[model samples]
Target: MKINNYQNKRDILIVDDLPDNLRVLSEILIERNYQVRKAINGKTAIRAAQLSMPDLILLDIKMPEMDGYDVCKELKSNKKTAEIPIIFISALDDTIDKIKAFEVGGVDYVTKPFHVEEVLARIESQLTIQRQKKQLQKEIEQRKYTEEILHQSRAVLSSVLNSSLDGIAALQAIRDNSTGEIIDFRCLIVNPVIAKVFGKNKNDLVGKIGIRKIIDKIDNNLFNSLVKVVETGKSLSTDLYYQCDSLKYWFHFIAVKLGDGCSVTVKNITSRKETELELKKINLDLETFSRSVAHDLRNYINNINFAGNLLAEEINLDGSENEKELIDIINLSCDRTMSILEGITQLSQLKSEPIKPISFNLSPLVSEILNYLQNNEPRINIKFMIQDDVFVNADRKLLNIAIENLIKNAWKYTKKTDETIIEFGEIKSTEKLWQEKIKLIDISPLQFKQKSIYFIKDNGIGFNSVLEKELFTPFKKLHGDSDFDGTGIGLSIVRRIIELHDGVIWAESQLNQGAAFYFILATD
Candidate 1:
């Protein structure tokens, strides 16, 4: 129905030797919103008909170079323009001329000085017939395509059912006459695997006793599941353990509704189940050992810290310069070691913690972080640009930590520069952006789905491109600790947090020009 109303107007071509006739027909058709093309003679009319292929044509019986009858004959002979409807409009009213018009493939004849209403009525009737014919042709082609697809699908399904290793059976529901309840299931079809599992030939199993009779020997749950599938037309699956003839076994059963019955599949998973139990026991033992080691290490660090403090207090101002310097170095080393231990502990805890996502505005959070950084380093010229009301759904605490680490890293790297420029905002994904950022090789611009891409850009002494791949690896450092102070775990923690929220983060940078870190958060 929608297809029938696709086009708002039809196209008409009017052919005549007289200029006045062409002008009059063109004006009438154009006024009705029908596209009109005109030709002064039959030769031009034939060329126009072949080029544009108008829906309908009006031709004069008498024309220069070629008559209307000859033009119609040439058009009907060509396959490209054969189906177009043609109506003759001329002053000739003799019966012979009218007969000749019909013989030359004209659908209708309109005498000259014809009534305007009659001409319009005829055109509308011909256009309506043409539209219906086209619709019928489309329906025929669609039906053929659908039939071919159905045949292919059936072949694929049959091959899969016959070749599967798992036992498969198709059952038809047998209902009680009076109660309309599913009493049992009769085996309509069974693959070779199913026959072998039941210790019977395939031919002997088809159209045999109800499946309930066989399954009841092991467990009644299988029968009940089949009954449920029939009643609700929904699939059911379960793992079953049973013993038959002094042999123990485990089976995974699945029943799915099909037509008036259900199809069932059974797979033996005894070996896989045993392997899983063994692995679970091994993991429990490893967890206990790790806890014991961590407890002992914490105690040792605490005792060493206390002893160092006591030694510092006992050493007086009269002590040698070298002795004092060595004591100070020992104390600083102890503190640094403690800091590294704390970072590692936190990183490990993130793996076990569950994330709680909530909706919040990102703009205010970024503003707060910037304010804190600015207060601590008042002399640094740090500028930031953030969009307003940028909302996201994520774990607020984890996101806060990630953003803080990134901003701090930018600040530290840009310390040597005269002015530090840090910009935080959103940008749309377009074809041009995709070409400019070649690192995004896997993502297409069309797949962005209108989601915002947020980035933090800074003018800093960026790292070498060769070491970019190791930026997110734990304890991976490109520079010496004295040059830049960090535990080398900040980016790794940031990456894990982003992954937990089903997001992505990547960076692009040059040696000393600048660096930009881009990320996307789940908006829904």
Candidate 2:
């Protein structure tokens, strides 16, 4: 049989042993625009099915070599052609045969001596039914694929949460059962590990707040992070080192953003933190040991060189002046080593000591420091402006050290006939922005009725302006040792003190012009 010339029509295989029947069916189907193929026997039909993969098969029950039942069985047995609908066409008009054909995977039957109109109608009806079945099967396959993806996604999320070394939780957006209002309070799922850590069951926590409410019960930081993640739908991560009972744990938690909710995981890094602390302790001990050895060596060398200088002075060397020169060299070297050792020891002390702050009157303290500096250097004139009745909360000793260093810096760097001007006062008002309100800071408390703005200006031989940032670093020298007669740790000490007091200090200078230092202390 030849196929009809139909555009995009479904391919059908007609299998019958009769030549007249095959010819008639082909001519009628060809006029109906269906692309049909023919086979005289079941063997030929199965061969054609494998070759062309027809969308439908029409088989005659009584045939030579192989019957239609065997052919339909073969087609239905194979996975490739099982879905193709099979309709039986035979002369026998028995209902038992129809049931048997249906059981063998025959979709419909056509009687022998078939009319052209009846055959075409049956063909059209079966084809329509087959198309619907194929569509339904396709939809079922697509549904299965979607379901597999969802299961894989859940498995991936579960593995990620379970494999985490830190405590983690996941929440979904659901309505509150009691209030009947939509809220981000439901726990869709939780891994087994988190359940064990929190001492809860995953089944019991399905509709709860997971670990967030549990943490809130214990007044933990997780509550805040959970709120932020839920409100903004953004990832929030932080390092939290906490102790439970006697065991210490360090956790870095990250909340990943998701639609309608978030997935949070925490990585426990207690071992890493312990390693860091152990390294820090070792470095501290080494630094302390180094400083101790340096101190003892400097003292011993200083004493030996001092005795050599005295002996060289007492003994007269008439022709050996080189021996005295060597003694002088030893003394100078010892002095330099002692100075360096002293600098290191002082810096170590600064790092070790805690800031001890107390309430004190800053006015009298500043005045006393200035008076002492003035008496020591009478050649250099001093212009002082002190803010009266000003008080602040700070360590008086540290503040004195800081102010004295600045004064000394001014004195050492100022040119000849230069005057140092020091003024003191408070920050008036500062404005801060917030989501709902603006905050204003008034420096009227602590009896500092007038906001203080302390400044030190000098007509000094200023150094390079490029070293502004490194000025507060220890041993960061701007002037040569031959020109300046002091250690370079002065500004560093000043910066440390200012930071301890929660204040800010900065310097402005130009090459050979002058230098000015400003200190702003928050009084309120």
Q: Evaluated with TM-score, which candidate comes out highest? A: 1
Which candidate wins on lDDT?
1
What value does the lDDT take at residue 115 in candidate 2? 78
lDDT of 1 by residue, 311-333 (tens): 77777556677877877877777
Count of backbone collisions in candidate 1 = 0
List model 2 lDDT by residue over 267-304, tens digit each.
67778888988988987998879877986897799788
Worst 10 residues of 1 by lDDT: 434-443
- Models 1 onward score TM values of 0.56, 0.50
After aligning candidate 2 to the native by TM-score, how far in Å is the CA of 67 from where it should be? 5.0
**Residue pairs with clashing backbones, model 1:** none
Clashing pairs in 2: 3-36, 425-452, 425-453, 426-451, 426-452, 426-453
lDDT of 2 at 476: 81
